[model samples]
Target: MKFKNRRNECVTTSDGREIWASRSVTVVVCIVLVCEDQPYILVNQRGTGVPDCQGLWNLPCGYLDYDETTTEAAMREVWEECGVNSLELLQGADCEFFSAPWDISSTPHDARQNVTIHHGLHAHVDRLPAVSNAHNEPNETADIRWLPLAQADTLEFAFNHRARIAKYLSHLERVAWIRY
Candidate 1:
């Protein structure tokens, strides 16, 4: 059988198992900021009207727009969510792929098979600055704050962000000596 996927790519498969290719792919970016000699991560609290994880904190993230590169999407999300335009990507922050098959909850509400490509970066800032929700979609974000790495571990996070944060924290610990 042959058909066109959501992105309008033609696909041909002999068997029925390949139907999953029709699902949409979303690129998400998260920034882990270390400021004032302490590691911190910027997270946003989901507002009540959000489809999932309302009132829960998670890293600044958003879907990749059409015709946009992952890096472009990452920078755009940071600016829109935190109002920070000056950001430097972490040296080795490559794309990490996560799919709904691994964790169904990561899938978007409308997708049958969703893949999220997450890119984590390090923000350059001396201190945490005030963030505004003015540019955020209605009820998309309730609040934004920079949480200490240790403190963040103790709080409940949306999706697999807790694990993702832990991984970043571990990376920071391993490279601390060199950075000092």
Candidate 2:
């Protein structure tokens, strides 16, 4: 029953067994849009000072705020990192927040030497936003682009983002099959 708190201090129980604290909880948002009859995912290049992923591509993501839900955090990350207000321009008839069908672990290793809980979210939009509309925050996002979902594997992604994209693709395939 003993566990480590946010400060990494152990909360002792009678048994005194230690449980690791989850220091990082993040929501990764995959914003999909149809361009020229193809699906593209919004991605960003990590800016300088971004721990392990600096200069590498990644899905728009950020640590969850204490007052936000995972879904809310996902939308916020998209807007902050990609400058696209997904919730307002949302137009997918099948639009919903879905995770991979497989048992993907929520807990993953962080470069900062902390336990991380990652929540993957997918949202399909009817149109693409102007690339110029996006803004960059210092030391967080360097560049933004709409990468083809099929080509996601071709790029080097920070952390487990590649796997997260694969999970989204899997969900799309499942949905396609379910339509029949």
User: Model 1, range 1-180, lDDT digits (tens) per residue?
Assistant: 986444634555776444334455554445556677686677788888689989888876767677977667666776676665524344323322121111212444542355565655555456666677777778888888777766886767886688866665555446443131
Question: How many collisions per candidate?
Answer: 0, 0
TM-score of 1: 0.66
True-vs-predicted CA distance for residue 163, candidate 2, Å: 1.7
Clashing pairs in 1: none
Off by over 4 Å in 2: 1-22, 98-104, 108-126, 132-135, 176-180
Candidate 2 global CA lDDT score: 0.65
* Per-model TM values vs. the true structure: 0.66, 0.72
Q: Over the stretch 10-122, how does candidate 2's per-residue lDDT look in tens digits? A: 66667997766545666677666665667778898888856666888988877879887766777677877888776564544254453321223444344444333343334
Best by lDDT: 2
Residue 105 miss distance in model 2 (angstroms)? 3.1
